[model samples]
Target: MEQGIIVTIDCETRTTREINLALREASLAQTPVRLSNPDCRHNLAVGVTTPLSVEIDGHVGYYCGGLCDGVDIRVAGDAGWGLAENLMGGRIAITGAAGSAAGATMRGGTVIVGGDAGARCGIAMKGGTLIVGGSVGVLSAFMMQKGVLIICGDAGEALGDSLYEGKIYVRGMIASLGSDAVISDLTDEDAAMLEAALGDAGIDARPEEFQKIVSGKKLYNFSTKEKEIWKTAL
Candidate 1:
């Protein structure tokens, strides 16, 4: 397909390998592609490195759009585990709920989930932003190193557990905080950022309506003096 041309691939008629090949080809040419009847397939468009637009018409299974760089992908239905894992750049939008480990270990870009997300959402995320329009499950943002996780609805227990430098914002009730995670006063800069991010993601809440969670920095260096904190963190 030529660059700028809109390509449509029906996933129901092709093998996974064939579909991925077509995606890669379209990515190289910077063409916008639409995938029909994905049927919750796994590993579709795994490693396209160029900037392109892709629209997946139905639900997707594990690792969909993983390891991609600078691609704009939209999933029209629910997503399985490890959605957009290790993404290097660009954006991924999921219209429905996501399974566990969504956006796991991603280095950059944005992931927007229109519905709820399961456990360990944004786990070990290194950079960028993850915006969830609904509630997130337990241990969400666990061990997150960097980036921002915005939960427009409630958050489950141990949210932001053992986090290094990531920030979490929740608009609804938090069941319980994780070890070494502390609620901090929302700064003006934080409010501005939240406003921009939420606005961009099409989330309707104001920044002041949310609470910010950050690392207490007690786990930066383990010591016997802080043994009690270490016990839970470890």
Candidate 2:
């Protein structure tokens, strides 16, 4: 492994503005950073484009690690809304629960949530992999264009609502299925894919336990007949 420089920031003692400046500086240098006392600040570590490792020791607010690419961020505690939103590349591991829209619109990357996530998890995701060890809330994966969403626990109502080209796997009970979203066959290839995703997230769950969800193809080509279903995407 390559040894990198370590930059530590004590959030409790420093202003959030100062902390963000230090974080940006370290990111520019491609150095590993340790952040303590996150204090629920929003937009921490957004837009990083370097290969860096960041360890956050406490809970964070909205948009943590958003728009990140080529970086790895690990949060030791719960995260607020939109964690890793619009991420392009890299990995974000959350050891605790996450708020709404976790991994929303992510194009590429891996986001692992160790606990339950709030509503709209993985919404509008164009590409990437999202693995949640616990449950997710309503409208999860709404309008997802492409990607993989794996839920090890129960999924809230309207799971995968209006899903377009994404693959959703839920291991537990689904309260309801979303419009244009239906249960699909879990093939051997899908099992292998789920296995790999679980392994990558360090989750010890059987792939066979999952149920797959995919677009119903009813709205794929979009005709007047599909108008009713298209409302679900909005």
Cα lDDT of model 2 by residue, 1-234, tens digit: 134567788888887678767777777777789998898877887888877788999999999999899879999999999999999999999899999999999999899999999999999999999999999999999999999999999999999888899899999999999999999999999999998889888899998999999999776776875776789778
Winner by lDDT? 1
Compose the digit string of candidate 1's lDDT tens values, residues 14-39.
99999999998888777899999999
Per candidate, the number of residue pairs that clash is 0, 0
* TM accuracy, model 1: 0.93
Predictions in order: lDDT: 0.93, 0.91
What TM-scores do the predictions have?
0.93, 0.92
lDDT of 2 at 221: 78
Which stretches of model 2 miss by more than 4 angstroms? 1-4, 224-234
Top-TM-score structure, candidate number? 1
- Lowest summed lDDT across 10 adjacent residues in model 2 is found at 1-10
